[model samples]
Target: MPAPTRALLLIGPLLLFLALVYVLPFLGILRWSVTLPEPGLEQYRAALTDPLVRSVLWRTLRICAIVTVLSVVLAYIVALIWVRGSPVQRLVVELCILIPFWISVLTRAFGWLALLSNRGIVNGWLQATGLTSDPLTMVRNEFGVVVGMVHFLIPFAVFPLASAMRSVDERVLMAARGMGASRARVFWQVFLPMTRAGVIGAALVVFVFALGFFVTPAILGGGRSVMVAELIYLRIFQSPNWGLGAAISVLLMLAVGAMLAALLRQARPGGGS
Candidate 1:
């Protein structure tokens, strides 16, 4: 076989799988988005103008942004520590990070609810210690949703960054320090720049995952607070509006695509932290 044909033959199965599983379903949702509810961008219009839908969409994006920021920052610190720390320290911190990922998402959400609820341990301790006159609302709100999502996303952000940080050249760092560069300057100029692509990639992965998150927001956010994913669920399962649900799914995919595109654009050239 010709070289190009051989390469295509090798890659064709995986490409076919992606088309069957991901691309086709995505395109189907895009079709549904247009066809649902009398067609012609009605769902898109509802997504923008309807007060409830708009509020949920805005809240979801805001939470995803906050989670992405916090996750990236925390992951950067943790990744640096992992790269530099003693073996035992690295083991402990890595395990601490992985433990959350291993735990079921539902269990994690339930644990957050237990800790943050009115009569839960956190509030109980606060009341006993005179931190407040009464239990503060924590779970079943925006705060709870954010807390859970951030917890879930930190690992997603950290793995990429840690892998990148591990690949950094220690000799370069030492050389910078030897040349009289301050610790802060060395980190900002050398270390951060080297890890920039991984950071952007990690942020993109976390943000996109957070965009379609359902369980964390649903369980922690209560019925009052709705995310796009939960709204999609309501449309499909609750109201039996499959078309509308598919339309929202398309919007979700588009939102995620926009984030990926932005991150990719920033990733080009010499972009860094």
Candidate 2:
């Protein structure tokens, strides 16, 4: 067996599995999006032009943007701390971060519902403390949705950033400091630039994940704050508009593919300085 043939043999099962599970199903979606009712572009045009679909798509983008920014900022701080912390501190922080990842997303969302709802723990505390006369409407809104998404996505943002931070040479920082550079200047000039790739990678990962989120937005946003995923659900299950749903899915796939391509270009060697 030649080296290339042996390598192909090793990867053949995984490739076959991906084709069977991913490629075939995706092709089915593409076919259905166009041909469900009749072979035409009606579904695609409707999805693009429908006011409701446009609103939902915009809302989804807004929520994902908020989640990505919040997750990246918070995760960067945490990752920086984790990188600088002692071994025990690192272990404790890692455990805290990974604990949420181990739990089910549904469980976490529901738990947030209990904590953020009108009569939930937070409101209960506010009222008990005479902080406000009325229970604040927190859950089932944009604020709640952002909170849930940020919590869910922070771990994802953290791991990539931590990997990037770990790759950064401490000696560079020492050299900068020994040259009489201010701490902030050293961080801004030396540290952040070195970690740019990781930051971009983490943001891309979080934004993409946030786009497809269903359970968190559904539970936290209530009915008022519908995202694209929830809209897709309603189109398929509630309204029985499978064609429209598939069309929306197709558009989303295209948008995500374009983003992936752009990011890949930036990630290639000699792509960025």
Give the candidate number with the greatest TM-score. Answer: 2
The digit string of per-residue lDDT tens for model 2 on 67-117 reads: 999999999998988898889888988897989978999999999999999
Candidate 1 displacement at residue 259 in angstroms: 2.7
Model 2: lDDT equals 0.91
C-alpha lDDT (0 to 100) for residue 81 of candidate 2 = 81
Q: Give the per-residue lDDT of model 1 (tens digit) for 166-234.
A: 889899999999999999999999999888888888989998999999999999999766889999999
Looking at model 2, residue 204 earns an lDDT score of 89
Q: What's the TM-score of every candidate structure? A: 0.88, 0.96
In candidate 2, which residue pairs get closer than 3 Å at backbone N, Cα or C atoms, i.e. clash?
none
Query: Candidate 1 — which pairs collide?
Result: none
Q: Please report how far candidate 2 places residue 105 from its true position, in Å.
A: 0.2
